[model samples]
Target chain A: MELGPYLILASLEGAVTAAVLALTAVGLSLVFGVMRVVNIAHGEFFMLGAVIAWWIAHSMGGHPALGFAVALVVAPLVVGAIAVAADMTILKRLDYDPERTIVATIGLLYIIQQLTLMTYGPEARPVEAPFNTRLAIPWFENGENGWQMIWPWGLGTTSYKLAVIGAAMTVLLGVWVLMKRTRIGLVMRATQTDREMALAFGIPVERIYALVFGLGAALAALAAVLIVPIQQAHYLMGGDPLLLSFIVVIIGGLGSLPGTVLAAILIGLSDGIISVFFSPTLAKILATLLVGLVLVFKPGGLTGSSGK
Target chain B: MSAKAKIIALHGGLLVLLFALQFVLPAYHHGNLARIMVLASYAIGYNILFGYTGLLSLGHALFFAAGMYGMGLGIQHLGLSVAPALLAGIAAGAVVSAALALLALRTVGVAFMIVTLMFAQAGYLTVLYFGEYTRGDEGFVIQQAQRMLWGIDLSDATNRYFAALILFATCLAVSLWLVRHPFGKTLVAIRENEERVRMLGYDIFVHKLVAMIVSGTLSAAAGAAYGLLFGYAGASFASVQYSIFPLLWVLLGGAGTILGPFIGTLFMFYLIDLSSGLTSAYMLIAGVVLVLLTLFAPQGLVGELRNRIWRWLP
Candidate 1:
């Protein structure tokens, strides 16, 4: 059995897996950095994004490509607004107590999930693949072409997956620039590191908190838009990603961008590879056990603070 | 009235009311009442960790599931009698819990909470993956719980209700003992100030592991009984939604108080039962109620009631 084309297919699949997780984990890490709340409703925001994008693409009449673009950019902002409202109304009042915040977010998660169930019903809805086309690379085909590559560049292609990867890379680089070289970003970092000192210096820490939460929500929503093509839009979809994102965040280290990215890719690729070889159920068990073992031995995670 | 006498009277009144309800209500309601009591026992265990000890475990259902699966495995496949099966379930819960605590107790706060949740999902999936032993997601049904002793005729509703009542009472007794004990006091101290407790030379890890294991064991008993009561056990028992119930119960009743989880359990179950009868979306109501309770009555029903009564009497 020839394994060359199959290996390329595997890598592409793995890359898509890594990108989706990293996209979602980045938003979670950002939210944790400023607010310190785990945002249990984080997955719902992603769900909303997927649902909205699906609806828009189905309704836009002719070209689905434009619909995909609109979803990548607009859905996130819409979801971000929801996140801002939640942050302003619930989290803002909780005063950043981890317990209360966790409970409150969990409560919010249920509300959102139930609402989504009410709105979408119990069935999983498939989003239209904006471009329904595939290019087959001639590996060991008819004698004329020897391992010749087809058009659309490489062997296999899913426009949706490619779009997702491109969006994730753009988001990561954009966020890095925003965090590393912006006036408000400087104040936000200062506030996270030393809230009292920043407050003493007249920084509007409250506004920063709200903005950061909204930004994280938008990022999660963006990921949701990308994920829908691969996994479809469904109410229960949030449950899997929510658990996976938590694992990624823990593996990456709370509030560390580099750590989150590296951890997300590592976890996502491993999870993908395992799922390819075994049942998704076994993969989840193995991944979680690994995380649990790591916590037992190295509670700080790959790059987390060893404050204790 | 003296506070001790009042407290005793209040508990007595509740017990009497619950017993009376079994007679006054229909058979189904009696079963539900039994279930409420059974579930309350589980919640009481959760309160030990979340309420009194100030630790949040988002995956408490692992213990519940362990007990449930144990009972299912014992009766259906292993051919153990009901009493032995239930004991086996509790033992299973204890073992799994000890293993989980070894890893989970290492982290604290949000790390502990999320990691515990991850493990809970892992536990659920592991059971699902080992479809051979666990029957995969299809689940298994126990024939019936055997008589507690030789020739007791354990099939009647009255016997079941009494059994549940006895178990609930035992759980309450154990909870009370735990809270009042010196070890319980240390748990509270750990909650208040882990750093100071550490400075005082107490091994916080050991204390947390003990609390977690005991909590898991009691919850497992409830889960085992619940499986027998329902006559079925499935992976859903270990899901995060199941984990939420105990936390909700403790909070609704008034965490850090002896009567909190009991009251919370009763209110939540009845509210859901009644609400489900009214609309299909009972979960929505429960979700809303939990949020409102957390926002407005963070101290819970018992706490709020006590404050009101104190104000009125004075």
Candidate 2:
């Protein structure tokens, strides 16, 4: 009821959003950085992940946890395979020209969306969380009882939400390790730095690109799978994630992975917090305008990295 | 025939054909053609910046919506007549585009696209936020009584067709004149090589700004005219889908070609119209066409024609 508890509640909501956004934006950042091409269908991959998770969870005749576990592993792989196919078939043929890639990805976005609408049938479907236990959060206040912890009504979150945050962090850490401590990452980075040089070094640049594209899409799908329980899977649900992650990727200085995560958190938190004080639509308008102004004034982004 | 005479004849003949089609066509196709001509005008406006000047804006819908609302609001709230309301719509578009150009022009390439997209997104949200006035997505319709231009009742089918034709022809002629003029050549040259154009003592920023304004104004005129002719103003016209529509039309028709927008609009309109008769998933066809075009016919229908048969095609 009090402002402090309400703020805490909003922050908790914000954390969940930030967790999902970081994954999605990081995925976009990776593709944008490495391939130097914007994948407009990135959000479609996210939607596909959510939809596939729903399908798997719905079809599997088992405990919700078992279905969720299977979906967690399967959705990303399926989406990743699709991404690789698309990359090989379309983007590769175009030689990854920036403008053409954008146009092609837009076409991919339409196809993916239309197919989903056809099969998914334009309804929002919810995936049952593996587990949900409302845990009340304690708040401290300086009252007559002096620095006492008190349980506040409606100041709680589901166990599943907390697990999502934890899962996202673990996956993000894994991605960081893969990028920094793996030979594949080295080859990818080398290709990103200089394609011709990477080719000279026998890096098999095209295969690396395919791998990177798949990985990026897999990351987006993973985020969608994690969030699908909290948010329903729908055909049109991809648009917001696409726009928000796009803003995050740009604000995070394009290909900088850390910057993408940081920007995602910043945007995600602000979006939640702003909704508390203003109409949600107004908050969206302000955020969109803010991103436009930022791009206008600081095209290099807040991290000051002129992304290649 | 001389090349100049041939170019004139081609454009003139197309306009004449469009004008004559109104007499013999059935009602359904006739109405679709009128709507197509208005949308083609929007695409032509889009081409001025994208095809000719190499500035690919993802937010032309903002200008289009601005005009629609500008005219709609003027009539609804301010009680202005049709002609003044139309001018008001165009003015709104000019101002909005000018302001957006100032901010958006600072960024180039992908950044520019993102900026325009963001602003347009914001514009769409703003429309939703102010739902009391603009009616948001549900939209408000202009009354038939107000849909009169001078002594002519524009609500009549024949008058509407002629009005659309007049608008389309004006846009076409303007486009034709711009392309033939040195200013239009400069825009084409800038599209080819911005650095070289700048080196040749041209103020690239001003040129781009002007192109943006002209493009925005024309799009707004279409939006205004659409609301007036069709008797409705809706937020959907200001949406991302609307922004992409012009891009798709220009791309499919042949960007930078004078007649490309009309051909693209006509082809796309019919493609959707005819296909929607069979199935509701016409967008699937649209998606496939876009991908196939990028793969095989990157130059588009008119572009291919120009490359293969009409080297003198504008």
Top candidate by DockQ: 2
Instruction: Specify the CAPRI tier of model 1.
Output: medium
DockQ of each: 0.59, 0.77
Q: What is the TM-score of each candidate against the true structure?
A: 0.93, 0.98
Q: After superposition, which runs of candidate 1 have C-alpha atoms over 4 Å from their true positions?
A: A138-155, A305-307, B1-6, B145-149, B152-155, B278-281, B308-314
Give the per-residue lDDT of model 1 (tens digit) for A130-191: 77566454555433766554333356766667776887898899888888899887888998
The Cα local distance difference test for each model comes to: 0.81, 0.91
Best-performing candidate as measured by TM-score: 2
Local accuracy of candidate 2 as per-residue lDDT tens digits, B222-250 = 99999999999999999988988888888
Candidate 2 per-residue C-alpha lDDT over A66-116 given as tens digits, one digit per residue, 9 for 90 to 100: 999999999999999999999999999999989888888888898999989
Single out the weakest 10-residue window by summed lDDT for candidate 1 chain A.
A145-154
lDDT of candidate 2 at residue B44, scale 0 to 100: 94
The TM-scores, chain A only, for the candidates as listed are: 0.90, 0.97
